[model samples]
Target: MKAAVHSRYGPPAVVRVAEVDQPSVGDKDLLVRVHATTVNRTDCAYRAARPFFVRALTGLARPRRAVLGTEYAGVVEAVGGGVTSFSVGDRVFGYNEGAFGTHAEYLAVPHDGPVATMPAGMTFEEAAPGTEGAHYAMAFIRVARVRAGQEVLVYGATGAIGSAAVQFLKHHGATVTAVCGTAQLELVKGLGADRVVDHTAQDFTRDERRYDAVFDAVGMSTFGRCRRLLRRASSGR
Candidate 1:
């Protein structure tokens, strides 16, 4: 099996395509022939071991294994003894955070781990980034407890995560206001944001109105600044 092997942590140059032994299927596992994968911020962070805290999972001295990838869209080539959910030749897309090696021709994961049947009318590459975006956006919205008729603001509304956040918040019934640059205002509005604030042109905090939740999707907004944008009863860290 050909894979992107990483012997060291640095840049994309450090990742080499090499022939490695194909992984064996364990009980309750599915052996997948990876068709596509996404290179997200987490992949880059793990590859560079940025922020040092990420090294705690990869390794302090070096990476545990060279292959770096997470979200995968692929077809199952084989299945293990206890696997009933999927069989050979089923199309699927999902995330594998710990066992991050989906950038190869073949990879194996437990049948129950984030893996799910691909949605109707979706392609592998299209589903690849969708899974990752959905996961993070769902996580934040869950934590925030956004509700219908409540006003919520998502900063950085045009980013990969931001775009997803806008839709997720709307899906959860929140009246979402998206913050982005002027160039991305239309894109944010199309994603279901009720209002689009051009961060370059206007400061959202200066508005007299407050919101139930203020999500700094880009981490570009300061704690004090965002806090001021929140209503007194809904302020949260």
Candidate 2:
């Protein structure tokens, strides 16, 4: 199997495509012939060992794992003895998350992991990135306990997580306000945001409009900066 492998932590130049030994399936694993995968922020973070703190998991001096892709969409080539959920020829899309080995021609994932049958009418490339975006967006939505009819704000609403957050919030019936660059205002609105704020033109925090929850999907804003926008309990005065 050929894979994008990186031995040292640095820039994009550090990674190279090389023929590596294909992974073997475990008792509960499925061997997938990867058709598509994504180069995501997590892959870059591990590649550069950014924030310096991430080294604890990636490695102190070098990456703990050679392969760096976290999400993949492909067809099952083989299934392990205990893997009854999926069989050879089943098309699936999912995230490896901590396992991170999708930047290759093949991947071995536990059948019961995040893997699921690819949705109808979606291509491999389209389905791959959705695993990461949807997973994180769903996590944030659940953590905030978002409810229908509540007001929600999504900052940096154009990137993977941000875009997914906007759609998810709207799907839950939250009135969504999305913040993004001017070029993406219409794009965010197409994702079902009730309002779009051009971050380059105005400061969203100064709008004086409160929201049930504020999600900084891109991590571009801090909680302290968005606190004023969060809904406060009425004093009944």
Best-matching candidate per TM-score: 1
lDDT of each: 0.86, 0.89
lDDT of 1 by residue, 78-136 (tens): 99999888989899988988888888999999998999999888999888887776788
For candidate 1, the per-residue lDDT at 89 reads 89
Worst 10 residues of 1 by lDDT: 228-237
- What's each prediction's TM-score? 0.95, 0.93
Candidate 2 lDDT, tens digit per residue, 59-112?
A: 898888999899999999999998778879989999997889999999999888
Candidate 2 lDDT for residue 222: 78
The reply for model 1, stretches above 4 Å from the true place, is none
Candidate 2 local lDDT, residue 119: 88
Clashing pairs in 2: none
Listing every candidate in turn, what is its Cα RMSD in Å to the true structure after a full C-alpha superposition?
A: 1.4, 2.9
